[model samples]
Target: MKFNNKIVIVTGGARGIGASIVQHFINAGAIVHILDREFPDSFDVGGNDSVFRASGDVTNSDDVKSFIKGVVTKSGRIDSLVNNAGIIRDNMIWKMDESDFDAVIDVNLKGPWLMCKEIAPIMREQNNGRIVNIASRSWLGSAGQSNYSSSKGGIVSLTRVLALELGKNNITVNAVAPGLIDTPMTRSLPPEVFKKLENTIPTKKAGHPEDIAHAVAFLASDESKFINGQVIHVDGGKSIGANLH
Candidate 1:
């Protein structure tokens, strides 16, 4: 996947899975732009002239719009967008706080909506673009994750709708639903919990961020022109069904 000179925007790319996507695109020769609230101390966005970093809140429409505008002004055009910005506030429905629900929905769902709303026009005008939304396997449903699941489910629907709305303009919109990828957030889980979660996966192992990045790169590439409005699961068969064994 040679993305030489391609301008790619990745949200929440300061660390973890988002950071991996940024690195992958940069390796593929895409001019990668990152938008995140804060970057990690170990974040090594160095050694790559194609990498650009910015601080912004995806949940803020003004911030999102301004960031996109700045990227366009500097890069002239955006070839692909990775809506990888998301938050998780897990709680059982009965115990969930309204603030937690609002926060998750705002960041996970509304953020992507705003991004697509702003970038859609630019892609349409240019008559070419690719959108890879980072949804989750949890969208299928998960206990104590009502809010998070709902938001990702909305992203799945949004991806499909955007594909239909933007297809005529030669744009492809798809989603990568990752399952149990090892990231900072997942690593924070209790060892017992993490082990149990790994056991549940058919592969009996967690995925790496690079696994998801590879899928995003494919969907973002021109080769996937015919594949639109689809959700590709990068979950090592976890989405197939529960182990039940």
Candidate 2:
């Protein structure tokens, strides 16, 4: 019950890591609101009434504002905001389309900025809040992912800046960097490619969505109030430069 009665917002909670993060908050007793383009036929509540689904786009300022307003209108205040919406269009820079790069940056980096902008005042007035941005260990470096890597790196920087600006208000901002998580996206890779990537990881395995969810939950909970502006890598040591030999 670390987050009992708290009002929490998660972007892209329909599936993958976001869905797990939403469930984590729900289990901890937080009233979780999800902002996504569309929720599935049913937003899985597991018989819990603490889940709210708002259909919206994080890249749209108006949508972002409306989502926040709707959540606050219902909950009266916001406690934590997890910016988790992201997409990838991987290709080498030479072969990548300009639109693809823009798209990735807009959704992955700008989306979080919009959410933080809309929530900053509310959290500031409350004088207490938490913000957790989902970055990627690929932000450090990754081939054929120039746009994705750049977007996640921007997330890392944004986390630090927001923590500096919001720390005085007792609002801590942090990030979770996930590496090789076993989600639909990763599983969709060709068998040989997937195996090669898995073999490259120090653990020789891809992490589950719950692993990322747990790290995100910790940053959003009271236990991490003092740990701000940091990026926690839940990558099974893959971020430490895995040995391919």
If scored against the real structure, what TM-score would every candidate get? 0.98, 0.97
What TM-score should be assigned to candidate 2? 0.97
Error of 2 at 159 (Å): 0.4
lDDT for each residue of candidate 2 in 9-57, tens digit (9 for 90 to 100): 9999998899999998998889999998977776576756799888889
Residue pairs whose backbone atoms clash in candidate 2 = none
Please give, for residues 1-245, the per-residue lDDT of candidate 1 as tens digits.
99999999999998889999999999888999898989877889765678888899999989998999999988999999999988888879999999999999999999999999999999999999999999999999999899999999999999999999999999999999999999988888888988898999999999999999999999999899999999999997988987976
TM-score of 1: 0.98
Clash counts per candidate, in order, are 0, 0
lDDT of 1: 0.94
Candidate closest to the true structure, highest lDDT: 1
